[model samples]
Target: MLVERLERFFQRREEARRRDYFYVTEVAKCPRQIFYAVKGFPRPPLDGQTARRMALGDDVHRRIVNALYSLGLAVAAEVPIPENGLFHGRADAIISLGGENFVVEIKSVHPYQFDQAVAGPRRDHYLQLQLYLHYFDLQRGILLMENKANQELKEFLVERDEKVIQETLDRFRNLHRLIFGEGRLPPIPDKSDWEYDQCRYCPFREFCLRDATEPPQDTLEERDTVPSEGAPEETPPEKEGSGKERPAPRDPPPEDGGMEEILLFDL
Candidate 1:
């Protein structure tokens, strides 16, 4: 059984390499529909404590990019990670200069927790960029954010810490494993448990209070999946007069995974 599982895992990994099955599987396994009830809660803006001082919209992220350009960094917008099955993530900017490739995730932080929480969200982004490094074998990543009005960019050393990611992949190898993986959707905190100001901006708040309706489920579950690894070959149809054969469709290369960026200059 162990050998069979190992064989299946390798076969799936090879399929992911040849045809980007990771991307297809991740999209197909997206839990947005499954988590609708939990996601339907309202959270406040990043700077809800200060009236009229909150950072709203894309302006905050744009400013950080401008700062990088001024510093002579070549930025690539909306990089796709096909290996992990993630799509066009607007990487604040990607810099490839001075013989170094830098994938920067832009953010803004709340002033009070600026020092403490700055690295929390970007850790995932850095890990994601590291995955991109694996797919193309690049090195180095940077998490850039607006520190007050300055772009505070910190360089991170990408390491080969495949243990956690391997665990995640292994869990995905079987339906039963994935359904009961560690940290499967943590418990949601109660209203009093949350800060007073942080409850207004949650996308799901209305749903939590039964005050609004949710988007249709069919729309969220419409993603397609890759063909089964080691699928049996099908006999080709005979051509008309020439008796020629048609080619099978080829798969695209895989990309990386999801990213969570830091925003809010105050933090």
Candidate 2:
């Protein structure tokens, strides 16, 4: 019982640490879930096991980034990847190698995730790194996966796909306008969609299902979006594989050893 209480306390503290901006990871999550989170709807406390797992994951991030900083490869660890003030996310590290820099994204995953993704990086993970590559204006990114049970690691390289970046920007931009600008909640994604597992484990599952305040709008009703305040209209992304040189990798010493970071995109 005492352990359970401790886990609950940690869970609450973690929630309190979450800032108001939609995180970069939001690109890979269901909008309705994001809606429930951003709206501050009440939900049950996460169970002890899940809470412990999450805390452990944060610890792993610290350990890995610290090691990289020591190795002289990491220019910056836990670098913020922000898209205007409305969206925020942190990349694991920015590493300089062979006179070039690449975005590094870390995942502490179950061993099964490794076996399942033997072919290549998972789509969601790729997409998350995609955001990092484009926002950081880097030509390439690396996905680093560490097996939770054994700490075994694998690395995958991804190139910046300007087209995908454009699509995601459009998607997140519209979501921002709908949720904050129009004063409307995001429509529920189709339950049959591949990523619907988020709905199953969602804390607000019952509330989301029972309250159909707005019918599901799969298209996100882009026409209805009013540009959000202080959010800038974005320029077109650079072409893919242009072989252009971006600004060199930032050469910043890792000051703190933890995962806290702050970066913003001007809107």
Candidate 3:
């Protein structure tokens, strides 16, 4: 029992360390969610389904890299980016194809998402790969995705876009200012009707909403202030029965809502 407890403790410590740094993949998420993370707000624990998917993604990444190496392709796995602590990320694998280097990113998605991706790269995925290419000084990258339903594979080639990279950089720089410089929370993302809406299923949804609903400290203090010195003090009304305090009122039920669940692949 003691050994088991020690192992669990170390596991938690390692997980905390992993979350301390911002990753390039997270840049495309809700800025407020990322802001809460960088500000060290406590996040809800990952549900079993989400945790399992993450593990499966990691296993697939390893298998793909090993297969490339066995086929005599020049491959470098888990290539670090930027070498700067301000931002952190690892490209899945850098492979040499026809004597040209390409940053490789692997993803597992549902059939619907795979269909959409086949037509063209998704916005978030496109931006993420662009950052990788920019940092690695490569002109192109490949997004390799597999359909979780039938194991079908598809790949898309993405060229580096300087405009997208600059926009992404500007956003992160602003996020850093909000978090560490001004000590203010970032604004919530505007609502969208997209299939995979980031805010609808964000883990920090409750935290951000709760902060929004609560009254500010100054307002609360003003409401609780006593009357001026010249004003008369009001007397409390006496109860005829027992003076035991009544229970506080319960909160109204939350509105019923749903969002299209998206599978996140970490490489």
lDDT of 3 by residue, 1-267 (tens): 686565444342111111334677675566666665544444445444444555666787788789878866637888888676456778988888777888988877666677765456656667778889989999878877777768777777777888879988887887777666676777645435222444445555555665543333433433333222111000111112333213312221121001122322211
The Cα error of candidate 2 at residue 12, in Å, is 3.9
**Candidate 2 off by > 4 Å:** 1-20, 191-196, 212-267
Q: After superposition, which runs of candidate 1 have C-alpha atoms over 4 Å from their true positions?
A: 1-34, 37-57, 83-88, 117-136, 148-160, 168-267
| Each candidate's clash count | 29, 0, 0
Task: Please give the lDDT score at residue 216 for candidate 2.
Answer: 34
Global lDDT scores for all candidate models = 0.37, 0.61, 0.59
Models 1 onward score TM values of: 0.43, 0.72, 0.70
Best by TM-score: 2
Question: Model 2, 183-258: lDDT tens per residue?
Answer: 6767655434232244434555554656533323442343243322121100111122323323322221111001
The superposed Cα distance between candidate 3 and the true structure at residue 214, in angstroms, equals 13
Model 3 lDDT at residue 93: 86
